[model samples]
Target: MSYDHISESLTLLQKDWSVDPILVDFMLGKRTDVTDHAVKVGQVIFHIPYITGEKKFILWKCYWPDCHNCCERQGRLPLTSDDLITIGKGLKYQKTSDFVKNETLVATWMESGPSGNNVLMTSVNLKRKIDETESDDGTHIRCRFLDEKGACSMHPNRPGVCYLYPFSSWLENETGRARVHSTYQFTGDCPGFFLEGSLDSMKETLKEYSNTIYDYTMKYTRTTREGFSLTSFV
Candidate 1:
């Protein structure tokens, strides 16, 4: 009953956090070694709470059309100069692609799914791996994808932990134990996932992925905090 594979599947969000927070929850530690306890968690914004005159055109950039996700002055993702420094420390890039220009990128950005192929600009909306079947069939993670459709055709080549759908992540919890569940949510408003579960349930799933986000954030923070170069840091 473990979905750790998804955790590894996603490269983890390596970028810095915006004030809004991608926001997801998860069990920090393991309740049982072999249990689906080590699951992958994620959460995404599902449109902002408001959209007035100025706010509507705020360029609320977290993906999704009617999504205000979290309107930042510059962008939903708030990566500081240090974060850029850390990014350099962690990965190697020749010429900056959309990530550099956009400035708002996820630790595990993806670009594949059921709808042919279009770069998935955002992170995983919700995920909790548990196979289909009466037995709860392990745990099938439903990584955020097309609205009512399948996922990217090239989903296999997707980067970051996003590819790790239906998976769970392990984090340090208050009781000092990592747990597992079978639900997840998207950050911004999405049409695909808006049934069965309520907002609270979606929030819980998001929290799990958020923790995984922090876990991956460490890699860059460690390097950037040290004033490392892009070559060495990345």
Candidate 2:
């Protein structure tokens, strides 16, 4: 799919999402707690401190069914081996014995990023599995962990990419410094960019983190052949 299409889809989602009031208040200093290191909305956070003096936030709340559906419609979701195992063991998928142990399933699920880094299929598959599981849209896309409600069955054990959804990490070439980036704004449609209120400073911090993550991912991809894994990003 074109970059434009991806950007548009994310933009639409962003517009529909509402910033958590708890997050807004926390960032605005309306809510204070010495022990408060993160915001929790369905176990989410508006701020996550990775490095000393570096602060990040969950700028956009993950809108469940919509986000899930969008990814399916676009055929861009991915899954990792661990995700497969978790779903299989959880009794979420039928015929788990046949599919989970199949090495060919492993090979077919592999994906390569723009940097030629390889990763396992946790979401979309180009080669459709000839079974009731695969979608007929030609993308062969199916998230095995996705529940009937459109929520991830393995939400807690989801991959790093899922944790950093609508966001990416990058690394600087010269300083070797890392940063975070918001895919929403980079793609140019996050309403969070236009949000105005007493939370300006908080939003600015999020922006800084966004940029940092972008560089961090870039540097990470350069040195890591397997690409960023779920545990590492989390």
Candidate 3:
């Protein structure tokens, strides 16, 4: 929870993370990009851009994550009435008959920055923790539909930020060569991660339309919030 705790965690993973020009700048607290932008890893680039981390978490990463890139640290996704309906229907939570009755009990969703916050973020900010909680910031709360056993029953509909984890990249150097730049270097309790393919190969793996989808996803998020988090769910 202290600043050094975040920085120290990242420093521990010294060899694991690979750096690129863009990532290096962000990690160094220089320039930065929104999480939606594509990151150049190795020869290929990933559509998952520099999504933001938590503010305290960002402080941890900035000083710790051992990230030398200047990519944006944390972000929150916005919520729409449609998203609430889709999520509620998908999770079968507070059913249609109960939805109208209980809907008012919950706000459809709350907005923060580029990444949408979940209940988890809320509890943490308030010093409360719940295994079933969604990631949250102090501002809003977004809940994930759970399964019978209480797992993410509707992960496919999970927020874009949730999907793009431990994944961030940027065009480094003036040439902007795409690459598998920064790896998760946090020594914190973050889980393990590995790109399915080499950073370079992953870039070439995308289809034409896939790139379009990637670009569109980045459009809505803006650099509204400025704090960062150093925690990694991985």
Show model 1 residue runs off by greater than 4 Å. Answer: 1-64, 69-72, 75-203, 228-234
TM-score of 1: 0.22
**lDDT of each candidate versus the true structure:** 0.29, 0.40, 0.33
Q: Please give the lDDT score for candidate 3.
A: 0.33
The candidate with the higher TM-score, 1 or 2, is 2
TM-score of each: 0.22, 0.40, 0.33
Top-down TM-score ranking: 2, 3, 1
Q: Model 3: what TM-score? A: 0.33
**Deviation in Å, model 3, residue 131 alpha carbon:** 11
Best of the candidates, TM-score: 2
Local error of candidate 1 at residue 139 (angstroms): 43
Ranking by lDDT: 2, 3, 1
Clashes of 2: 26
| Model 1 Cα lDDT, one tens digit per residue, 42-106 | 42222212112112111112233443111111012223344444443344544334234333333
What is residue 24's positional error in candidate 1, in angstroms?
Answer: 23
